[model samples]
Target: MPPKFGTSGLRGLVTELTDALVARHVRAFLAACPHGGALHVGRDLRASSPRIAAAVAAAARGVGVEVVDCGAVPTPALALASTGAGAAAVMVTGSHIPDDRNGLKFYTPSGEITKADEAAILAALDAEAAPAPAEGALREDAGCGARYVARYVEAFGTDALDGLRIGVYQHSSVARDMLVDLVERLGGTAVPIERAAGFVPVDTEAVAPETRAALPGWAAEHRLDAVISTDGDADRPMVADAAGRIVPGDVLGPLTARLLRAAIVATPVSSNTLVERMQPGFELRRTRIGSPYVIAAMAEALDADPAAAVVGYEANGGFLLGFEAPAPAGALAPLMTRDAVLPILAPLAAARAAGIGLEELAAALPARFTAADRLQEVPTDRSAALIAALTDDPEARAAFFDTGAAEAGLDLTDGLRLAFENGEVVHLRPSGNAPECRCYVEAASAERAEALLAAHLQRLRDRLG
Candidate 1:
C-alpha cells in the first residue's frame, strides 16, 4: 500500500513504509518546495522512526539539500525551529497509531503543509528522482529541543504549577522527559510512571479502556493531583483528573481558551457542543474535523482582527495559537502548529489560579458529553456509500437510526452529521488514514453519550459484518 497524507500527515503500516517508498515521498516533497536551505529532520520514539528518518535525510541530501538532524524531537519542536530558521522539515512519526504503523509529517518554513502543498507534493511523486548521494553530510542540532522547552518555561514562568503534584505517564511519548522537566521547573512535583520500553500509541481523544481504568489506580498510588501524557509524537495531550477521569479534549480546549482570554476560538465540528454554550463571550468558529481546517479558520479569525487572540484546538487536545496571548506568567508567542504541552499546562495553571481542581473546572462547563468509537477494517468506499445513502434519503436515515421520525437536520461539511429531534447528534465519517469508519456522539450526559456511541457503533458493526 502506498503511503498517503491523512487528516494529519502521511501514515501507513510499518511494513508498507519501506525505505524506498519514504525516500520517494521525501524527494517529491523537496521537489515541490524547491528549498535550498537545510532540511531539519526529527523523529519520535517509534521503533521504526530512526530508520525512516535516515531515509528522509538521504532523500534530502540526494536533492542537494543539507540535513539538520534534530534527532528524536517532538513534532512541534521541529516545526518551531524549522519555521524560525526559514527551513523545511520532515518528522518521522506515526503519531497515535500502533507500533506496527509509522509515518512522516512534512513542514514548510511557514508551518505545516497546506492542502495545496499536499496536492503539489502528490503531483511531484511521479517526477524523475534525483541521483542518490553516496554520502550525505548530516549536521546535528541539539538547540532546537532546548528552545522548545524554553518556550513554555518562559511563557508560563517557573512557578506557574507550584503546589501541584502532577503525575507524568512516561509512555513512549517523545515529550515525556520534556514534560517532566517542565513540571519540575514550574515548581510542581513531577512523578514519572509507566515508562515503557516499546512504543505506546496513546490516543488522547478516545483513550484505551485499560488506560482509563488504570488512571485512578495510578493517581492513588502516587497521590497525584493530576496525570499528564501525550500521543506518540507528543503533539496531542492526554490529561486525567485526580479521580482518574480523563477530560475530553473539547472540554479542555475551551478551558484553555478561557484561560488565555482568547477573543476568537476555532475547533472542529465534532467537538463538544458545550464549547458553544460555555464560552459565550468569545466568538466560536467550527470547521471540518482536521487541523488544516481549524488552522485555516484561526488564520481567518486573526486576519480579520490582528489584535484579537485567536486559538484553535482539535478534539485530540492539540492546541494552536494564532497570536501571542496573555499567559498567567507572561505573553506566549504564536505557535501555529498543534502543541500538546500548552494545553496540558495552561489548563492546570488556570485551575490553580482559580483555586479549583481540574475536575471542578471541567464540571463548571455545560453537561454535554461526547463519545467516539471506530469500526475497524471498514472499507472507505463502503463507508462513503452508506453515508451518502443515509444523507440523501430520509427513509434510509430513519432505517439506519431505527427511528421513524424525519431527520432534524443534516450537515455534510466533513461527514454525515445527523441531529435528531431528541437533541442527540451522531456523526459518521471514514477514517482519513485507515480503513475504518468513525462514529461520534454527543448527548446530555456521559452515560447517554457512551450508550449512544455503543449502540450506533454496534449497529454499524452488524451492518458491516
Candidate 2:
C-alpha cells in the first residue's frame, strides 16, 4: 500500500516507503506547514529508520529549511525539544506496528497537527511549488534525550520512587536506556531485563499472548515491584504490577490524573468506563479513538477554562499533559502530545507515596476490567463491511454478539460500542494504523472480559475466513 495518513501519522510497509516517497511527503509537509526556521528530525530503533530519517533531512534541506537531526530518540523527546525551540519536527517511527512497516509523525511548532492539517498536507502533495535559491544547513542536537528525562526529575523530584525495585523490560524500545536513567535518577533500582538486540514491536494496547505469559515469570524472578516498557518509539507504555498483572491504559490514565489533581480529563470513548466512576471530582470528555482526537478534545477543554488542569490519554497508555500542574519539586509544563513517561512514573511514585504495592494501588480502582485484541492481516474493507452490516441491522448486531440481553446504551462515536443490560460493554473497530480488526470488552471481572473478547474475536476470525 502507498504511504498515507492514519490515526497518528503517515504509515505504510517498509518496502513502500522509498526514499523518493519519503522526500515527497517531507517536502509537502514543509510546503503546507510553512515553518520558517530549522526543522527537527528524529528516528526510532528500527533498521530502516536511519535511512528514512536521512531522506527526510535531505528533503527538508532541499527546500531551504534548516534540519536538526535528533537521532535515535523517543517520539516525545523530539516533540518536546522542537516545540521548545519553536520549530516543527518529523519523527521517523512506526510506533508499535510490525517491523516490516514504518511511518512519519509530523509536529508543528505549537504541537501535533490536527485533522485539517492532514488534509492540507495531502492537498499540498500535488500543488505546484516555488523553488528556493539557496541550500539549507543541517546540524545535530544530542541533548534532547537528557532534557526530556530532566523534565520529569525536576517535577517529581529525584526521590519520587525511593526504595523501589522496578524492572525495565528493555525490549528494543528507543527509550529503554532513558527509562533506566529516569528510574535510577528518581531513586529506584532499575533492573534491566529482557534486553533484545533486534527491534520488537511491543504493542501496549493488544499485548500478545507470549508477552502476557512472559511478564509474570520475569517479575517473579526479579522480585520486581513492577515491570515497565514502551512501544518502538516509546510513546505508549506497558506496565505490569508485582504479580505481573497488566494494568490497562484506561486504568492508568485516571490514576495519573488523580495523582496530578487534574481538573479536566479527556479520553477516547473506547477507554475504560471506570475513568468516569473513579474520577468524579474532575470533568471528563470522551472523543473518538486516536491521539489527535484526544488532543483536540483537551484543547477544547483548555479553551473553556484556561487555568483548568487538563490532560488526555488513550487506551494505548500514552498520557498527554494539557496544562501545567504542580509537583513536589516544581510544576510540569504542558506537552500536549501522547507521552509514556508521565503515566509510568506517576503510578509508581503514587504507590510508593502511599506505602502500598503497585498491585494494591491498582486494585483500589473500580472492578470493571477491560481486554482488547485484534484479528491481524484482515483487510480493511472486510472489517468496514462487517461494522456497517451490524450497524444497519439490529438482528445482525444481536446475532453477532450472541447475547440475549438487550443493549442499554449504544455509541457510534468512533466504532460500534454497545452497553448490554447485564452491565457488560463491547466495542468493535478496525485498526487505524494496520490491517486488523480490534475488539474491546469490559465486564465486572477480568475472566469474563477476556472470555468475551476471545469469543468475539473467534467469531470475527471465522467470519473473515
Per-residue alpha-carbon lDDT of candidate 2 for residues 327-403, written as tens digits (9 for 90 to 100): 76789999999999999999999999999998899889988999998898988889989998998898898888954
For model 1, state the Cα shift of residue 111 in Å: 0.3
lDDT of 1: 0.87
Q: Rate the local accuracy (lDDT) of all candidates.
A: 0.87, 0.91
Stretches off by above 4 angstroms in model 1 are: 34-36, 129-137, 402-406
Kindly list the per-residue Cα lDDT of model 1 for residues 167-186, writing each as its tens digit: 99999999999989989998
Least well predicted 10-residue stretch by lDDT in candidate 2: 126-135
Look at candidate 1 and tell me the lDDT of residue 120: 95
Relative to the true structure, candidate 2 reaches a TM of 0.98
